[model samples]
Target: MTSSNGLSSLGPEGASAAARALSLPAESYGNDERLEAMWAMKAYNHAEVYFNLISSVDPKFLKLTKMDDEIYTKFRETFRDLDIKVLDPELLKSAEAKERWRPFCNCYEGLVEDFNFGTLLRLDCREDYTQDNSIFATRIQFFAVEIARNREGLNDAVFSAKSSKS
Candidate 1:
């Protein structure tokens, strides 16, 4: 986590490099405080895990770094495109994962009108802070979470089926 300089965890260049690696505009992502938080939580290791996934796919520098350089590269590109302000790998992955699962959620809502305890377990919950009114936002947030959950379920089902077939 600590950069080569040893003054800060990510020195000025290292932070900027990390930001650039995440593809944020200058001064956009991973401020010192957020980096500090990541260090505190040992999120750096998770970032490394993600980096490994990317490395397996790309392998641009297979012998140079232990980390997955490719996934880090994708993260950079995505963060830049999304204009994300925060610098947490899990949050970024969650957002990315949400996109993949959104469609399954949309389909589930129209087909299911009732919920039981098991039904509730299949919902994806999200907080909506951007609504014009609190009531609408809360309602929409709940709906969105449920849809997200359904999408996730669909994804799991598909993945399981594929694995079984293989």
Candidate 2:
């Protein structure tokens, strides 16, 4: 698929957004050059798929990944004070948060496919996948934070109002 920006999208080419891929249109970027967020499109795809999943299914029935328990547990252990519903930008951007997140994210390196692939994560569980509320993060970080949000019942807000209206 192609984005409106004229650059061909690296997503939706018969591969799950979670798949491991290191290729990009070399013509567009030259051999080694990369976009600041190489996986933004994929991240957007992932966020949409994930949001739809949570909207349709209750958090208790949601299983984000094979390592859901591990990711959620470790995330909670590492970030005891995290406000999952609306994440602080500093938590994902500051140098210090990265320092604290490195070990935790690396733990799933081999166990989860494409664990380090760049992806977009929504800063607020209640928000849609708008550019303003999204941030770049590794797949594992996305899993960890999103899993925690689902399990904590924070993401129920996604479909709560709509469901009630219906």
- List TM-score per model, in order: 0.17, 0.78
Off by over 4 Å in 1: 1-8, 24-100, 104-166
Residues 1-166, model 2: lDDT tens digits:
1135322443466344323333543355444333444455556667667777777677667887888988888889999998878888898779999999899988898999888888878888888777788888899988888888888888888868556766
- In candidate 2, which residue pairs clash? none
Measured by TM-score, the strongest candidate is 2
lDDT of 1 by residue, 1-166 (tens): 1224332466688766655544433355547675444433233343233233322332222222222233234333443343222113343236775574344334434333321101111121121111221121111222333223333342234234434665
Give the best candidate by lDDT.
2
Give candidate 2 misplaced runs (Cα > 4 Å): 1-38
Clashing pairs in 1: 22-76, 23-76, 51-68, 52-68, 54-71, 124-145, 124-149, 125-145
In model 1, the Cα lDDT at residue 142 comes to 28
Q: Lowest lDDT 10-mer window, candidate 2?
A: 1-10
